[model samples]
Target: MNVKYKLNLDVYKDRNYESIIVAQNDDKSRIIECKLYADSQPVALSSSVTAAFNATVNNVIVAENVPCIVADNAVKITLAKSMLQLAGMMQCELVLSENDTILTTQHFSVFVNKSVINTKSKYEPTGANLATKNDVNSAIETASAKMIAKDSLLNTSTSINLTSLEDTEQIANGVTISVSNNKITLSGTSTAAVNFYLKLKRAVTLEQGKAYCLSLQNFANIANSGCVFYPANSQKVISSSWLLSEVSAFKNAVATYTATTSIIIDAIKVAIATDRIVDNACNLQIEQNNKSTAYANPDLIKSSIKPELYQAPDYTMHYLYVSNDYDEDTDGFGVTKFNSILSANDSITDNNYHNRYTIIVAQGTYTNLQDRYAGLSDVGLVSYRGVMMKDYVYYESENIYNPQATIIKWDGATGFDKSTLKSEDIIKKCPFHLDLNVHTHIKGFTFDCKNIRYALHLESGGTGYATNWVVANCIFKWGGRADCVDYADKTTVPVFGCGHSFGEVGLIENCKIIPTHCTIGYQNHDNADNSSFGLHMKTGSNITIRNCDFCGTEIQARTLKGAYSDTPNTVNIEKCINISEVKKMYSAPAERCDWKVTVDGNEVE
Candidate 1:
């Protein structure tokens, strides 16, 4: 390995030579020797003595006998002085291990005699898994600026490992990437987001101003919280939780990666997924005595933290089907009560952050969002749990005679209207919305459709509105029946147990899908094209489903496009805990069984 530093004689005042400590096979758990060279007599000392000399030896996570001096002619250290610093130098080194051996070596020892200003490194930056335009551009600009400052590094075409971005081979060059207000921006002069991804396959050509793109990528297993502004000059990684107040697991996972490498946001997230592996069905499984047909526990989604750290269904809310004004015992005041508490403050707006506006489902089942008024208007985090609907509304009312007609029944659009089916209905008409949108979080509720059409429904792209819906720990059973999914008296629709898409951010997890997981088509369509699936997820939807109980599900999982089927494959029904029957008439997602999904070392079964 060669030292990569920008050459500038002015940076260093004076120096003879620098030494890099490499671990030898002499010790399995600790390093035994230090290497350095000079014109003649070299100084030396033991590593253990150096560790004992430090004031705070326990904090460092590096190996003992750290390099102490950067002397021009003193190739080694004097053991007497070295032993004095031993206690403070105790450290360990964690490297990319091969066959359980460390492989990190220091080069550029000859820099002491040469004119090298960037003594340590002018190393390349780390890459993001899925980078936006800003992330890519910022990285490019930063790297280029540093390269100009340091005139010593070789223009070597090195392969940088960006672990997260999926669907794309590698990060494209010249794609500026930046993070602002929790949003990643990627843009270029000539290339767009799609074109940028396509260009990365061939040598990662950096675009001048054509790159334009954005992506949402998350890092997992980051132990440190603060950002490393620069990693080349010095790898001063931060890991002290005391230094940063609120550190999430995502921060802890990417602790080693500093500003030195590029940000491949897409690649990093993909790598994070690989880091979580246990042979069971869950990443974190907990079944503290859950009985059959039991009401959801108040602790179903328990967290003491104000804002859950690294939580799924992170920040998005849909309307509460059950009205807040209605009675409670059923809700146990789950979301209903949380809503009241969250609304006490006047700082949040209805559409901007917190919204009192919610969905009120009438006591019936409908096939589509045809009702002109049956929708929550620009609300964030609607609360809907513990809702029951039976013989309620079935009429499709249309008024082409009056497109701008106004119809507001009771307080909602889906209610008992004794009128005839028109061309436009209040609940399923134009401009109808099926989403409550951003900052959405729903939990601890069961929707029993009473053998009617599937209990819940969300229309695809109502007026092309983006959906940020999060359905957590809710039960939607008896979904495959004719009266349940997409109403056709006998029409079977390609309905997942919980189907909602069309640019919808559907994050469904931690719930039970009784009688069936997700079935394809409503009652009438399956007979037309026979098939059954426990769950069907569409692609391009930022959906993540994890830690749910799927014991006796009819079908396990399937993916239409980019959507991930949370359900793993090759499931041994006999070994699965609690779940008994599951039907997958069609094939399941590929490589579903290859992963060993377990949480806390416990098998989901």
Candidate 2:
């Protein structure tokens, strides 16, 4: 009879770190728990003499469904259930090898804890007996009309402060407003700073067309400071009105104000500052770009987080948080203040120090880290996304031959030279590999660069790519240089494209990209290969792109790129919002591509 079995590996061993059968009871048994070796051994694996296993965070996983690992001296024979089921079908007939030899297979059975499965109550399907449907549709349709209802969501409460602002004042000349609690008062104060950067310090809005200036005479230390007006839409350091470089310039314009015109500060910024500094003075409140989380000042964030039930022996990091001030001192050559470390500046790997629980970075600007900290290893930085203090060197894309600018990027690699560094080096350095995953989040932030290359480039054994990965509510831009080669002239990549190297079956909801111009032979015209399209629907299904906003940043129209491309991928593209001037740019390219284009409120043709 043919033998069969099923391989099952539970979430017992270190899933985050390198998995090994440690000799706990002098080789009789091994310690099995996830995250044991995470810090030192990033990738982990299950142990078997000659077995195969697939692992997941919870429940049973198929381990070695293919072939059994041969234990030389253990005399353990593991067979798959499929093989035994096939043998039973053959009425217990002895299966012979091709050489007419007795094929003896050991059948191994894997038992999982049934307690792990989440149970739900079962319900009966539709309608009463006899399948009698007494005009249920009509009754349901009229139920709303017959019921009394009121819409509360249509109205939102808003009140303006009559009191004038303090510290500095109006954007317009000859007026200064100050506020004492709710009481706002206006005063005659002229000679406001023309330096727009100064005006935004206290509380002021950034006007696109208006430039509020701040004079340095009144405020001391006017030599190196200005105000910045950062609106809600900024991704990079680019500020509005005179383009603020730092926080000083951005706040300088609003510092000294007039009596006539007042400030229009972003409501969210004030709330965040109030929560962090005013209320919870000791706690940290992340308020860089108030996007999705919205100045999220979580009350008792520690209680919301599970007090980590486990830790790996190799996990080197004991703490993770960047300094409040990270961008300050710089080298004369204008790299990073740490670059001038005539010796080892900051270190995780030091004499008798393999890892630490805390790493604090001094305020400074760092650029082009060319293999300076060569000995650091076994470190993990865990924090919520958009924690604006840290500047990680996430690889953008191929520099073609230049290997620098954001362009077409490949998958994540394993190791890199610290001295001779590339973009991929950052990924290899982060101490811990993740086992827990929160859906619809990768990198937890977006990178804004000129013509960004690969959006997400994780290498083989890529982690964090799962079913609930949501790629939404973001925009990607790319610009072509005046000088370029022939190959790039024809083949512009898509805004977001995952090649054959994706372990994810997630949804790409509400993401947009502008493709480059393509030419014949150089890149495929009207071809999905040349242009990566806004989203790649290759590997896993159950994906959709709904309510997405996309448009080509460049004006060149000879290329053949629209909202999507036809890659014969089985995913739906519904309600895609295309902001392209070209009519053809709005077409959806999937089998279930019945698009319902809604422009504001009206349906498009």
Find the candidate with the highest TM-score and give its number: 2
Residue-level lDDT of model 2, residues 542-592, one tens digit each, is 334466555523211122223232332223446655444322122234333
Query: Candidate 1 — worst ten consecutive residues by lDDT sum?
Result: 278-287
Q: Candidate 2 has what TM-score?
A: 0.26
Candidate 1 lDDT tens digits, 501-554: 333454545555554423432111010111122224322233444555544433
Per-candidate clashes come to 162, 78
